[model samples]
Target: MDNNILILSEGMQTSIQDLGRKGYRAYGVPIAGAMDKYSAILANKLLNNDEKLPVMEMTYTGPKILFEDATLLVITGADMSPKINDKPIKMNVLYEVKTSDVLSFGKLKSGARTYLGVKGGFLTEKKLDSYSFYEGITSQSRVNKGDRLRIENYEAGMELYSSKIKVKRSHFEAKKLEVTKGPEFHRLTKKHREYLFSKQFKIGSLNDRMGCQLKNKFPPIKDQEIITSSTIPGTVQLTPSGKLIIMMRDCPTTGGYPRILQLTDMAINQLAQKKENDMFKFDLESSFDFLGRLVFRFKD
Candidate 1:
């Protein structure tokens, strides 16, 4: 089938992403997926597509896309001022596009990433059981200008609805990130532990998909090194120099620094929307409270 959409301008860092490649960490593969999974899932959910269906993950700026065929889609996460043929469109709402319709974005109003999900999802190349784009793992890491993105054909007569959702503003503006004690959390001195939860840490300029570094540092620990151990997304490591690193979606599978805290999945999602120099505090959750919340969620 002919490509359904043409990329006129490849935004800052547009890429294809879904839930990510699972079960490959043992082979040293990073789970390169959408930084904000919650928004991505909402995009797919509104379009009635599979939650894991690949969507276009646009960064600070957004790509200018020309639809070659009619399709249903939804925009979620960041408010980048999306428009169709120069007409402004709302985020978290279902919209229909016909052949030749041009979709573009303007100045970002909130959040760092945006998700564009079409009905039936993008028909992109899948590697390692996922369609997420990653350097060395996927053929292309990010979409380039003039790229033709293949998408499933829209059924002309399919039922469509005017659906919209109101996402909480706090989801983007909140400054507190809930975290749990990591395997090495107890190694820190009582003073250091108190300091971690007491101050707001600014995101360093080196933040990216791999991890986010905090500008504020804790006092250096006497023995900050640990034997390289299994690490996952949300792992917060403390380096010997007192630097704190919060692992993100594309972080390595293992690390040697002291893992002092782990952000909850929701906290990770919240952190994904933050940008350089954004200040946030860590709200440490007790083990008992964490388990209680988990049980309540499962029951619900």
Candidate 2:
């Protein structure tokens, strides 16, 4: 595994991410992981790697990489029009890249983030028992140009595996996100509650790994704040300024804003693929309803 990839250009925001460091939220640490868990898992699975192995989480733009050795790579999530040695290649399929092969991306066609998984996963220093990068935790928050990432067993015999496997792209297109009542869901006035469900929200341009700031056309809430309490990814808090913030995988472990709605695990995954300016509605469901849908989706 002495082979390494030299980063020629760091895209908008590229970072090594895994399933995130869990069980550290009590210490006010955020779970900084891949924004799109489904895509990360798919990329890893295609390489027969661990389901939670670290992958490159490329946002908006993708990095330019020069492989020092021939290795298998799988691209999932957003279609960034990847190319090997300047030859256009399709995504969601494993392809062998020869030594000195240059990999890069073109304009984004769909989705916001893309997952790049190497043959044996990208080797990086871990913090809090996880490889996911965080600003204050990991030594490096994001990959930069000229950085070298060691690839495990890059020169070893390539394992024989499926030549190409296609994952349905339609699963990433979601317009409605399912949510459940949060702790303060009942505290809102009747009109406010109705407005929350009936109105549409647009993903603000300021959205990032911390959370997705939503723009609402309605009036601002009357400065109703709550005592700082525990929060986690998917916690929907309504700011006094009338904006809605859907916490993401990198959001802080707690907050003081009023928690109005909480997105389900599936909803969070679906929302992660949405880019700025995308519009989506929140559909509230009961606990039983949520579990029922979850079961049916994964029954196989």
Candidate 3:
């Protein structure tokens, strides 16, 4: 019999994701992948699987799955309260599941996203060299109930029983996001710069994988329009109306708004676990001064 996981209930937003599709952004493809890359990678690492292996990215809630074969698995990110046969399981640890064992999740104790990694990864379609499920780029955007996901049937070795990993609690609790000056940072006036760093910004209602809109508006720049330029995950754009949008994994390839700040890779992962109404402050460090100079030279 082929190994498979039968989906009993599709939770809020469960989908297959890896590290995201790269090199296709120039062609206008949004890199849709696991929002919390650190947790996703950690889950894979704990399972002794490739870090880039496709795993289930569960948002807010989690899906109920029935295992068809014995396999090693691990859960990380967000305390979604995972369980097997109604018995609780710990996060960041590897365990074996037997045939007919059902895994489910309860109340979200903390964080906003969760990751489930299985040995050998999932046998899913790989488009553009990625298993990331994007709206138009992939056959289906999210997993639905009644879906049977293929997996590898395997018996765990002794190495699986001795694996142990510790996750940092700060990743989900930190409120200070580290960012570097972006291409248009030089355009901001002294007052605007002060406002950017001084105030706390709330995650707006329009938050998702595409981007995060901040509720607090910064003072709008006199010249709000800018020539359309390349954008990537973590590019913080300030709009004419003064609203700030932090582009995420599924943002467009280019944007016209002024890119005033860019979050560090770690900051992007940090922001990914934040939900609407979450408060955070910018921590503009000087470590990226050299990169800021390079951006200013070309953008100016």
lDDT of each: 0.92, 0.87, 0.90
Residue runs of model 2 more than 4 Å from their true location after superposition = 155-157, 163-165, 218-223, 292-300
lDDT of 3 by residue, 78-157 (tens): 99999999999999988888889999999998889999999999988899999999999989999999999999668756
- Superposed Cα deviation of residue 23, candidate 3 (Å): 0.9
Query: Which of the two, 1 or 3, has more TM-score?
Result: 1
TM-scores for the candidates: 0.96, 0.93, 0.94
lDDT-superior candidate, 1 or 2:
1
Report how far off residue 132 is in candidate 3 (Å): 0.6
As a whole number from 0 to 100, the lDDT of residue 5 in candidate 2 is 92
- Backbone clashes for every candidate come to 0, 1, 0
Q: Which of 2 and 3 is ahead in TM-score?
A: 3
Query: lDDT tens digits, residues 187-221, model 2?
Result: 77889888888877899987889999987754556
Q: Best lDDT goes to which candidate?
A: 1
Candidate 2 whole-model C-alpha lDDT, 0 to 1: 0.87
By lDDT, the better pick of 1 and 3 is 1
